[model samples]
Target: MQMHQTARNDLLLDVRNLETHFFGEDSVTRALGGISFQVKKGETLGVVGESGCGKSVTALSILRLLPKVSARTVGGEVRFHGRDLLDLSDREMRKIRGDQIAMIFQEPMTSLNPVYTVGRQIAEAVQIHTKASRSAAMKKAEEMLRLVRIADPERRVNNYPHEMSGGMRQRAMIAMALACSPELLIADEPTTALDVTIQAQILRLIVDLKERTGTAVMFITHDLGVVAETCQRVIVMYAGRIVEQANVIDLFARPAHPYTQGLMRSVPDRRRGRQRRLPEIPGIVPSLREPIVGCSFAPRCPFAIDICREKRPPFLDVGSSHAAACWRAEEVMGA
Candidate 1:
């Protein structure tokens, strides 16, 4: 796939043909199948798809954070600033991981430690990454809390994870992730658990932080609306592969892949009066254990033809920096 064409200097991350799998006793689940994309400096790249589309796996693979017992990165390279992370030793990868490339998970409750105060956790990251004393790191932690727009940052820093509200805890998580001023941040549905108002607040905080720090962001979410508001470019993944990618404006205006089109149609239109049913894509996602022939989404695609069932389509460039992995890309775009 011709996944990226980033200039040498502007690119911060270039993930190429990454494949990750989970090995059980009798079965192997292909979680990521040759997914490729690039994140430029100070850019926000959105990866949108339904559940089980390998969005989380891709993030985990990049950080080499998957459980050693079951998950294994079988093939492909994750290039971060021209260095292949997969080739790095565990000790080397650990140094790069929070200090250079950080991640904010979906649930702050699970990610944060109940035993320690929020400030201590953030300070720990700073101390590990830099040669700062405990007191200095703790002060930096308070600064991080204030940077994220948390109220009473001095007092809030001393509070435990369970003591804060959901929004506060999420903001704390962001502060912890941004403690070291990472070059690239992977936010996996960071606002998924927040209320609409809180979600907007967190989104704004992330955007503002990105602008202030010039850090590239890899935003992984199923919310197209969130993508519209935050991302400059977006890639639509389906069944472990990128089915389409384009600029956010072009993607929303003219989605070239069948899956992308279905996702766009599924969004509710408030202008249309109350409807009996909102549009939905039919059929459940197929299991990854099953051998997939041709296109993985062919069975669920409305535009699937004989060739779609028999042969997998290549990722074809559809113009204007857009690409789609579909046999009927021209027909779908009405070109």
Candidate 2:
């Protein structure tokens, strides 16, 4: 009763059947096909899939950052704190973007302004959202640099984006995103370009900062290892749609969807010891430019049946708090 109502109230971001499309000369790429999910307060929700699976698109669309001319959110509602973001004007969306919700984009090198100093850039975000004075925002920026564990923050704040190392720039991005203490932070492959050691450090820093700020994080990455390490729950997307949703343990233990199982098999298992080659998912991913007739993964799924190619499977609960969009979910899980 009371707890249930409280839980509902805790739903920070609710995306309902979000449909996004990119128009071209003669084709329409269905970038996001009515995908829906929820991000609760202070939880790290991972959205993962191979490239072109709409993970990044989902983040951009939720924040209304997609291009205006070609790309449009054709349908759906992105409700943040019970207010639909889709209905907000551009000015209103801008306010919400850095203040209430911040995002760390894929590439820090390009995402950060080359001409602006790191601290100035961070302070700009703070000033926009907090309306702080120049000196005060600069101070806040230095504090954020320290918060992200950047050494010599006082000196580093004056450094331009190009002057810093890849990982350092990424840390700066995180700092900027957190300067306002946003309620939800969307990170799109923030560690993809860093070295193994740097990647580990960034991941730890994000987890630490997220805990310290009590900010809900929507981590979008193709790395299952990162998801397993940082996220409590994850959504597996395929061809712009969610194929499975489960907690880290359940998903790794018992993958209910064939596509998910394939992805798991593709990951290197050190326990198995040297193999000739890693197992691969057969066939290429479907092109989103055309309408998919049935289950998008049917062509590549080994467990796919005739029905899989004939009809789209509903996203259904397979076990407690675990769901998959597969008709053969039980069989796949058991096997």
Candidate 3:
């Protein structure tokens, strides 16, 4: 993959050849197969792929929040602020998890503690990370609620997650995640469940907050439309590895990878006639448990050749900063 020179000095998070796996009694699942990417300061980078394509795993790996019993980071480095996070002690990682790096999970309902008021939960995080007094922490929590544009924050902060509407609860989650002014925020499909209007509002709120705080963001989602709108650069993942990476504009204009092209075609086009059916990718993602010698996406690729099915392709730069993991990328893109 092509490494931009600017990333050498500007990146806030640099993940290099990171690999992760989940072990069971009888089988092992390769959750992340040598994934690499960088998130520059105050920039939003999108990681898009179908479900089970290692998007969430990459996030969890960066934070070292994977399940202790089954999952392990086998190789590579996750460097943040020039320090390799994989070398940090548990106590050390604890300090950075919320203070410098935070994550907003997909579902607020399941993530927020059901028994405690939202205020208490956010306050507790502040106290734990900053050593603030309980009263001071609560005050900060209310300010965070207001920052997220929650109405009547003074009263709403006291409401439990279940007491608030879905959008409000999601806002509260964002409030908690940003309470410490993290330099890097990993948002995993933060707006996937919201209504269209609410989704737009949340996206706007995130973009606004990032601008105000100058915080870099790694936004993970399967939505291409969201990527085009929210991210400056996009990484298209497939079968636990990245197949393409490029600036959003270039990617939309010319997707070099077959998988990336297929994803773009699958997006519903309002410009087309009303009776038209959106194009669909031919096959489901392969199970990670099965060994793949060739390109993992070859089974579904329309232009797959004999070599494509027999040998894995290296991720190579096609032109400029655009990179793709297909042997025939030039032909596919030009066609």
Top model number, lDDT? 2
Tens-digit lDDT track for model 2 on 176-277? Answer: 999999999999999999999999999999998888889999999999999999999999999999999999999999999999998988888887567658
Residue pairs with backbone atoms closer than 3 Å in model 1 (clashes) = none
lDDT per residue as tens, model 3, 55-173: 99999999999999999999999989778999999999999998899999889999999999999999999999988999999999999999999999999889999999999999999
User: What lDDT would each prediction earn against the true structure?
Assistant: 0.93, 0.94, 0.93
Say which prediction, candidate 2 or candidate 3, comes out ahead on TM-score.
2
> Which 10-residue span in candidate 3 carries the lowest summed lDDT?
1-10
> How close is every model to the real structure, measured as TM-score?
0.96, 0.97, 0.95
RMSD of each: 2.4, 1.7, 2.5
Using lDDT as the yardstick, the better of models 2 and 3 is: 2
Model 3 residue runs over 4 Å out of place are 1-7
lDDT of 1 by residue, 1-335 (tens): 22443336788888899999999899999999888888989999999999999999999999999999999999999988788999999999999999999999999999999999999999999999999999999999999999999999999989999999999999999999999999999999999999999999999999999999999999999999999999999999998999999999999888899889988888887765577487678898989997789998888888899999999899989987899999999888873
Q: What is the RMSD of candidate 3?
A: 2.5
Count of backbone clashes, every candidate in sequence: 0, 0, 0
* Poorest stretch of ten by lDDT in candidate 2: 1-10
| Cα error, candidate 2, residue 286 (Å) | 0.9
State the lDDT at 298 in candidate 3. 94
